[model samples]
Target: MTAPTPAAGAPDRAAPPGRPDGTERARGIRGVQPVAPLLGVLALGVCLVTSLDVVTAAVALGIEVALLPLLRIPPRTLLLRTSPVLVAVPLTAISIALYGRPSGRHWFDLGPAHVTDGSLTLALATALRVLAVGLPAVVLFIRVDPTDLADGLAQLLRLPARFVLGALAAVRMMTLLGEDWRQLGMARRARGVADTGRLRRGATMAFALLVLALRRATTLAVAMESRGFGAPGRRTWARTARFAGPEWAMVGVLVGIGVVSISVAVCAGTWRA
Candidate 1:
């Protein structure tokens, strides 16, 4: 007999050849392994942290700015995500300028704070460094899926499967917290208990959320244990986490940026320990 046809309303199961399914495509940055961006960020951080000079940070920041277009992030989303870094850079600069080791000609002096030429320079370098490091990290992790990251950690990096899976579960559960909080608030409002004593109401809601989270965690742990998640046998993955050319290239670019930034700082006699 001929093969049977699918049900009339059955969803299409076969993805187009050489193209990712909807779920994989939604994870973003197709063809680049999840671990690649993580490794790139780590390499960049290591390179940038070695120097406390303006030249190094400025160079890295400039390079990052030039490469932003390649990330393909929408302008609005980028701004919204990077807003924390933007706010933090100025605050960090101000703090460093006021309290960082005082040297050179003093610009301002207060009871226990001083702003000097040296501190000013340091502040500027620090601001740029924060922007350089924080911006790329924020952007790179924007579309990272918890499951994908866990897969990468376990398969690509050879991390402990139990730990990776546990952390992945925690991350997945954390996303539900926002919805839980909203539901709790609505429930409390319906009972007419959230209209007054804002601080007390918040504390009560938080305690309730904590209890719920604990219960959920306990249930999840039991379910996972029952499912052989913590078994001693070698674990297998559903999806292979590949570290290929694109991943390597991504890492190389970040490392190269770091190296060039440090080299410029050293050559310019602005390098610091």
Candidate 2:
């Protein structure tokens, strides 16, 4: 197996990464279990309330925002995690604005695309809903190491141990994907084959990365099997993943936010089917 390389633009490992505030907060919340279940509950609530309840969506988003400061998530890390929403939410909202169920006063029309009060309302709700659903999961997971997460899943969730560990190993290699890509680019440049069409170069690099990943996966599997990993039997966890009071409180808070938001929307007569 090739030695692993650091990602080209990753921060140096001189000291532990993460902001002081975030690291401190992580200490308090680090070893909890049922992390996925909490996030799933929040996501399900967002889906139920977002379609025709703009007020509920907005309230839920506000609750999530408030929780961010409590979590002490640094701005840089938060930005990195939530950047996908910046692109995806707008595109999704635009599509809804242009082609959603038309009602109320018409705003504009272009070919098959049309905008109206109802669609514009839906667009705003959709954007808020995405933020409400996505931000919490990202913030919560920023401190979760993949190996620990897999352990939690296998133990608390009673998932297959071998599969969970294997998936965890794959996730741990994600940073290597970037490192490998950078190395490949450098190698190509050295061979005087770098100055090619951008699309073609990208395709070649991607294919090489895929092959590298497959090789690494094979090596990893062999190593694990050699250590009695795939044997069907009970396994012991080095660290216990407990879903105690704090974890339950966290889940309850999120559920309460969803319930309260929906109730308020219903009372305000803004809750639509």
Candidate 3:
């Protein structure tokens, strides 16, 4: 009996030729990814444990930021300078204060609610924990080129290609959103229906952007169907994705963070007891 031939069109399994990051900025970004796996790991841990022992997570973040040069991601594009994360930081804090744990001593009772020192402490811990976890994911992913990340995730974690491939395609098309936005703005101005007041203008701009996005999305769907992107066949990778030194280093960093953070929490508990 003849062995069944491997399915046609599977992506190549061999590691591809490597390229070096020559830009100082890219170097810094690349450096961060090694630590990013760690930061992201610790952040996930803190979220699960919800404890104040975030020294490990903080340390992981610090290392990742310091090594940011190695990730080869641009600071501006990588969410290093994004406003959303900054906004999230404070919002996390507020959430803790409003809905955090109830405490032993009630400072005040506002009918069905009591505010206490314990709740305050819990809120603080919760806020810190959230930021510690979320920041790294955002940082790592923002700077990460979608294609590279999809490649890494697929090869290292063995994720199904369909989803990752779809995400990659989506990201590749995101660039067009900006151009569409510009055109939509021009069109709105031409129609004389655009808002002039600051409050209305901002809202109008958001609505306009959303409409432009929806239209592009429709166009993209039609384009994909026409191009046979969804056809069943072996796909080829233009760039080789490998989980070598960088990936291992990242995992090691994460494990190290888990050890350190949990250890500190244990020590602190013992001290209190």
Q: State which candidate, 1 or 3, has the greater TM-score.
A: 1
In terms of lDDT, the best-performing candidate is 1
Q: Ranking by lDDT, best first?
A: 1, 2, 3
| lDDT string, candidate 3, 1-273, tens digits | 997765789764554344444332322135433334634465456433644534544554455566567656666776545467667767876656555677677777666555777667666555555555565556555545555667666655667777777787778878877786677778878988665776786677778788877887788778877876567877666655555576666666656654565566566562111
**Local distance difference test values of all predictions, in order:** 0.90, 0.78, 0.60
lDDT by residue (tens digit), candidate 1, 1-273: 998899999986876433255443436366577799889989999998888899999999999999899889999999999999999999999999999999999987998999999899999999999999998899988887777788899999999999999999999899999999999999999998989999999999999999999999999999999999999999988788888898898899889999999999899998997
How does each model score on TM-score? 0.89, 0.81, 0.66
Candidate 2 residues 1-273, lDDT tens each? 998988999976654443444352233354555465455556546554545668978988887777678777789988988898777899989999999989999989999988999899999988888777777756677776676677678888888998898888888888798889999999999999999788999999999999999999999899999998988777887667777777777777777877877888888998876
At residue 70, what lDDT does model 3 achieve? 60
Better of 1 and 2 by TM-score: 1
Segments in model 3 whose C-alpha atoms lie over 4 Å from true places: 1-28, 31-43, 46-82, 188-215, 222-228, 270-273
lDDT (0-100) at residue 166 of candidate 2? 85
The per-candidate count of clashes, in order, stands at 0, 0, 25
In model 1, what are the clashing residue pairs, if there are any? none
Shift of residue 112 alpha carbon in model 2, Å? 2.0
**Candidate 3's TM-score:** 0.66
RMSD in Å for all candidates: 3.6, 8.5, 10.1
Cα deviation in Å at residue 184, candidate 1? 1.6
Ranking by TM-score: 1, 2, 3
